[model samples]
Target chain A: MLRVKSPQDLGAGLLFIFIGCVGLYFGKDLTYGSARAMGPGFFPIWLSWIINFMGAVCLVRSVTLEGDPIATIPIRPILWVSVGVLLFGYLIEHVRLELALLTLAVVATQSRRQTDLTQKIVAGFAILFGIAIIATRVQTFAFLKPFGDAVFGVSQWICLALFAIYALLTWGERDARQTVILSVCMSIAAVTIFVVLLGQAMPTYTADYIAPVFSKIGSIFSSIRGR
Target chain B: MDFNVFSNLMTGFVAAGTFQNIGFAMLGCMVGTLIGVLPGIGPIPTLAMLLPITFGLDPLSSLIMMAGIYYGAQYGGSTTSILVNMPGESSSVVTCIDGHQMARRGRAGSALAIAALGSFFAGCVGTIFIAGFGPPLASFAQKFNSPDYFSLMVLGLVTAVILAQGSVLKAVTVIIIGLLFGLVGTDVNSGATRYTFGISSLWDGIDFLPMVIGMFGLVEIIRNLEQESIERNPISTKLRDLWPNRQELKEASPSVLRGTALGSLLGILPGGGAVLAAFAAYTVEKKVVRNPSFAFGKGAIQGVAGPEAANNAAAQTSFIPLLTLGLPSNPIMAIMMGAMMIQGIQPGSAVMTSNPDLFWGLVASMWIGNLMLVIINLPLIGMWVKLLQVPYRLLYPAIIMFCCIGVYSSNSEPSQLLIMVFFAAFGYILMRFGCEPAPMVLGFILGPLMEENLRRSMVLSRGDPMIFMQRPISATLLALTACVVLLIVLPSFRKTREVAFQE
Candidate 1:
């Protein structure tokens, strides 16, 4: 009896063999022209065979070699994280970016056991409001257009305010003061680098609302250059 | 030997020295170090996430920044390996053996300083090697015909199979699976769909960004989540004890030089780069320093210095194949090739002639980036240590958010997000089976090119299959591939290979 010493290798080998079989079956219909005049299927079918052969070799080796045993899978984290990501993908298309991000943060954080319910909920809401403010200022959400021209034309100062509130509520006093400070600095740096310096195509604010502020800054730079 | 090389490099410096380019380089170094400090987030996912952002910049600037991130991550990965005993990436795994031991003995600062200094020196040498060798290699590659290219690709794929850190059979199987996945779109010759299975998004082939994000980024998160908690050792807080003593420097200097030479040489070979170089350096250093002041694994500065130098050197020189022959020696270079194609620059010999500014500018920026990394990292050690202290619970969600946002923004298609989810599950399964993802990534990137070259060669030869063997270069390459395959198949060699990876 050939005992399977390496279950991981055995599983991988079987998977590869199955995939190769599937590839061969699917590629059957494509033309396999002569080697001199190769068709679409010529290269793929050959590769499939080679894969199948390699898989068989792996299967044989699994019976002979001793290796690390497979570890127990963490189903809870995998499920929660998968659902969280799927939800973001699903919601980003249908709902506003702010709502999608909020839902994602709440759902994804469920995977962790350390955080309290109150903190989780607070973090969720803070993410929701913070993103809404950031989106309003940064103009990332296309759906927000339906709110007319002057709907929540918050200044950049609101972004700073929302970040502070989010940081305080989410991070709390649990030795996360450094994280909070780092986050603030990173955001400021990102905004300056991506928006101010690089002049990325994404809108920083509503055209009519922030035009005067930028123009004023632009005039100051021009005057400095002229001097 | 060529004066044109020096003149071109100077031109490249002039182009790359702009304030904006330098700023981007600095930004890349900072971001790279930050992510590298974080466990489970390597350069692949970081680059995948930043792909969209780079799309907005010019090709030269984007490439320069990306290269900076790659090298900077290598530097940052060593920090965690030394201090926390947790290797942030595969290449840093060897560093942990002696590096963490040094940290436990309250010599964390010395280990970090030697690693940084060694890496900087290796990076400089590697850059100079590229500047000297890149042009002649490109010009030589320009003379290669279809059969030669096909043979070269065969050799490259074989090398990939050999270098993969597992059973050769399993690596080959994974690579084939990757090629099958690459065949999911319309065939260029017949315009017939291969494996789309009626999905509209499969019309243009699977997007590389989502696949990479799913495999490297999302899969890593799930794996990290499996652990109940990550155990982290406390780091020393003293800044004054950072520098190595005179005797320690004397011991480290020769090892660093040897490792650099080994890394630079190996980096040029197909499928041999930073990971292999680091391992080789460590193994050689073990033999070279027979009478170490301390035991081999107990706070040996040579161990820290040599591998760090080798890995950085290898990382820089790995650009040779991609820049010269349009062949990616590894997955990271494959991604770089993809980035180039996205920017409308076809990789290979033509790039040197067609876009001299882009080529030389990227090279010059690499040197600048290495300098910037040293300047940026030494002072920010405390901040990085603080970053490592952030709980996985909080850190992971932020990473996930970035991945989601990055994938979503890549094509602005909701369907791409679905693709990421599918590949994440697929990648998790692959991981469970002990199949490495690096070979698959290389296969996916090279599959189409391989097919194109094969067909072109066959057409040129008028249906003769022996054309590959008939050509001298092709025959030589095929022989080399056979030799490598034979070496792997031999039981004694296979054992040594497995033992090397196990360490």
Candidate 2:
């Protein structure tokens, strides 16, 4: 039977109240000792009560005063972005950093679809790979390097990513053939950065069955170079 | 004893002047400028995003980098405002007014120069102010008992509520809720965990990185993405003649001086101090300047200089309360406090005596960082302006990728990502309800400390409530708090505050 003049205020009031109740309910079990011998619950309980009182005041104000209406919230952006982030998060340790990054960009683009889908896909994957390479320090092929195990510098990996980003981004007005070429260039740069620089232990890719084959291939190449 | 400031600074310079620290400081500045020039990102998210990178750094080096980022971001924000009329940071919003107008009227060079020079002068003065005042304040803080500390926090929280943007009541509730959130995790006194929901990660309390990145970083990206077309068309600025003319300089100097003085004082207060300082300086300049080459909004150099100086000065001095009293006056300082805690160092008066090198080194690095901003950013304005053309569609995904890697790499646990998702959703909901999540962070940081001090005070008083009134420091702080509360409730002050924000 209560009329809400300001939906924003009303919603905020309800949220504050709910938050207070959660605090109170969860903290109920802890002993609320006297002030002189205060227990864990003492301060929290006091704070929760104050929050509840504030919420009640907000509720009264919501009905009594004129205020702003709640603005319409766009759900697509938040949903797609969140989905993309979560996908990257869960996929990083399993699928590897590169694929996870690619998945994130692909998912995020779904929030606002455009006719330049091919370009979007290319730029998104390119820039994201650049960021991923920077985020987790690139691997140094310390064990397999031809420099008698002496590795190159770490800065080159970042430069590789940076170059890939600039190359693909500037070619946005071009056709898909160029996009593919740029993408290939970026991938080669990424692999070289990971393999040729001071290595980090970050997993770039991981598949249970294919892991043995890659390591086997690496061992064979190292053995061939050792002679 | 007063002469010790020089020796202290000498030590600070020696410690922070190392090539390693300088390199980190410059790196932080460059990264910070890149983040700040990009619209839709603020210092809070940028700081949260870059926090993981500093994990491998020495405490002093990390703090230096963080401070560099803070100042560089603020400076970069001003540049964006001058060049594009899009205020990249909140404190630079007023700058966009006359600053962009100056650009439109072909005095963009003058505007940028005045702002940069004014900010440089302000930053130097602020650093000196900290050097002069920090020790005295810390020494005085040493005299504070548990009750005094408790009262000080109460005063801080009250003032923060008053100074925060939007409704007074709502802000109060938000802070209270934050305090409650801070109470989650294990209680130091009792060794019992509260509100963890049986999760192992909750035993250590909520992780700061996930909460911050989720709330500020992720939410920001989502908000930016919501706009139909995130196209940015920056005004083409000619940076060839970057010096201000004699007349423009002469006009802006006095206003800059006034702004620096006003800001240094206001910055010591709690909550949104820099933002308020900028806003207040604009009002002061309007009243003080007798005439202008153009109208106030029509490219007045005084309008551009005063607020820019004030905000930079405020940003520097806002560290006073956090450094001396171990209280975070704003959310930004709260993050600093969190960083210090993560580094296993507690911020307080003791830091001056116990970790003199780190304290003075940090203070010295601030000056170096400011110098770096002026030197590095002036030449790089063209590069930053070009960055404005990078489409937002490409930017957001990169930002998200960076955030996820930072968060995951920091803890390397899957649950941390889940925590981020939770905070992002919570922040999004709060945004819809017109409730800010910023003040909550301040409260959360203070929560456990306040409880510990409060409980100790109660014990010292033998359960008597009047002990707070008996102590001089406590009583004075309480009195100040009462005055602030009265100011908030008063109709006249409220009207003025409303008018101030309206401009």
Leading candidate by lDDT: 2
lDDT of 2: 0.80
Writing each residue's lDDT as its tens digit, candidate 2 over B122-230 gives 9999988889889999999999999999999998888887666678888888888888878889999999999999989889898888888898889888888788776
Candidate 2, residue A104: CA error in Å?
1.7
Instruction: Write model 1 residue lDDT over B333-361, tens digit each, in one string.
Output: 88888788878888898888888889889
**In DockQ, how does model 1 score against the reference complex?**
0.39
Off by over 4 Å in 1: A1-3, A62-68, A114-227, B1-3
What is the per-residue lDDT of model 1 for residues A56-171, given as tens digits with 9 covering 90 to 100?
87788789989767666777677777777766664454443444554465566556553475345544544554454345434567455444223234323333454455455657
Each candidate's TM vs. the true structure? 0.87, 0.87
**In model 2, which regions exceed 4 Å deviation?**
A114-201, A205-227, B1-3
